[model samples]
Target: MDNLVIAATERSPAVDFDFAAGVLSLKGESYPEDASTVFGPIFAALEGFLGVAECRALRFDFELIYFNSSSAKALMNMFQLMDKAAARGVTIEVNWFFAREDETMKEFGEDFSEDLEHVTFNLATTQN
Candidate 1:
């Protein structure tokens, strides 16, 4: 499938999905007025990709600075899907990046990682 790239906006993150490389990344703040409008297509493409992914491994990087509750929910759902894909024998790795000074974001990443199984989740920090 073709790559998916969405430029970042004031209220949304940038999405870069390299399907051929099996790598995806989302960066910036996420508090879109309509989370569905921003995430629906991504969810669809992700589901379709995961459904028939033949790649040996997939990597997803989430470098979000701030996100509202709806974005959190969307991310949890995405994580669930990734976990399910891992259960299906696809190797999945998730790198959740937070600023070193942002304890809240660090905790959020920890909370999200708690329920994951099969998918390898890592929490990385940035100097910013």
Candidate 2:
């Protein structure tokens, strides 16, 4: 399948999901006018890809500078999907990257990974 790429906008993040390579990354800020409208298709695409990915090294990178409450919910859902895929034998790695000075973002990342057991979750900080 073709890779899914969504360019970043002032109120949304960029999404780069490479199904064949098993690398899915979301970067930049995220506070879209409608969270579900922005993330629903992404969720669907990820679900479809993970369903047939088999045993593979899947990496999901979330490098968000800022996000709203609704976006937080969407992020949680994405993490849950990754966790489920990992539970089904996919070697999943999730890297949550926040600004070095953003303690709230770091805490958010921690909260999101709290229930993840099957997937390896890493809290990372971007360099100055």
Q: Score every model by TM-score.
A: 0.97, 0.96
Q: Which candidate ranks first by TM-score, i.e. highest?
A: 1
**What C-alpha lDDT does candidate 2 achieve relative to the native structure?**
0.90
Writing each residue's lDDT as its tens digit, candidate 2 over 1-128 gives: 77899999999889999988889999988888899999998888988888888788999999998999999998888888888889989999999998899998999989988989899999998995
Off by over 4 Å in 2: none
- Span of ten consecutive residues with least summed lDDT in model 2: 75-84
In order, candidate lDDTs are 0.93, 0.90
Q: Candidate 1: which stretches are off by over 4 Å?
A: none
